[model samples]
Target: NAGVTQTPKFRILKIGQSMTLQCTQDMNHNYMYWYRQDPGMGLKLIYYSVGAGITDKGEVPNGYNVSRSTTEDFPLRLELAAPSQTSVYFCASGRNQPQHFGDGTRLSIL
Candidate 1:
């Protein structure tokens, strides 16, 4: 399996611009998740889906939206991005255990 991969690695956005940080997994795992980690804190769940066509909000879902249409892709959308949205985004997977993570997509807003 290719595990999870995130694009750009790093990005800088103005106060109001937006973008979709891409995430894809080659593993056939049924569970996928998106999380954001602020400095010196644990990961906060943003969104997750158990399977295709099923999705749900998570602890830090505000300012972000996600769609899980296929088994391999779960892209996160940021609209009217704000400085508070700046954080390291991580994509993960696992069924009954801890998740395997991407290096992370580091985003900064100025």
Candidate 2:
């Protein structure tokens, strides 16, 4: 019934700044995910939630935080942004494996 949506398609931040990458889905999925893809590299899972009020760390959870307050929202937070954190972030949702992905957020840290 819905697809993934991400905000701030692009952003530039100075080292140590903090920001939240917004993600939302309207498909009423039980599984939601966040992933970061560095240049020339495959996507690394940052975090995932099986349902509302539950979350778990993934392969590259450092420097990132996620919360699933409702089935439709899963936001990724970055505190003290670092240059190494620069990458394209993708939000996905599905019943099993991800079925929908947002356009992606291109983040750059100076």
Best-matching candidate per TM-score: 2
Q: lDDT of each structure?
A: 0.88, 0.95
Per-residue accuracy of model 2 over 1-110 as CA lDDT, tens digit each: 44899998999999999999999999999999999999999999999999999999999999999999999999999999999999999999999899899999999999
- Per-residue accuracy of model 1 over 1-110 as CA lDDT, tens digit each: 57888886999999899899898888777888999999999999999889888888989999999998998888999998999999999988777333777889999999
List candidate 2 segments past 4 Å from native: none
Q: Which residue pairs overlap in candidate 1's backbone?
A: none
Off by over 4 Å in 1: 96-98
All models, RMSD in angstroms? 1.1, 0.9
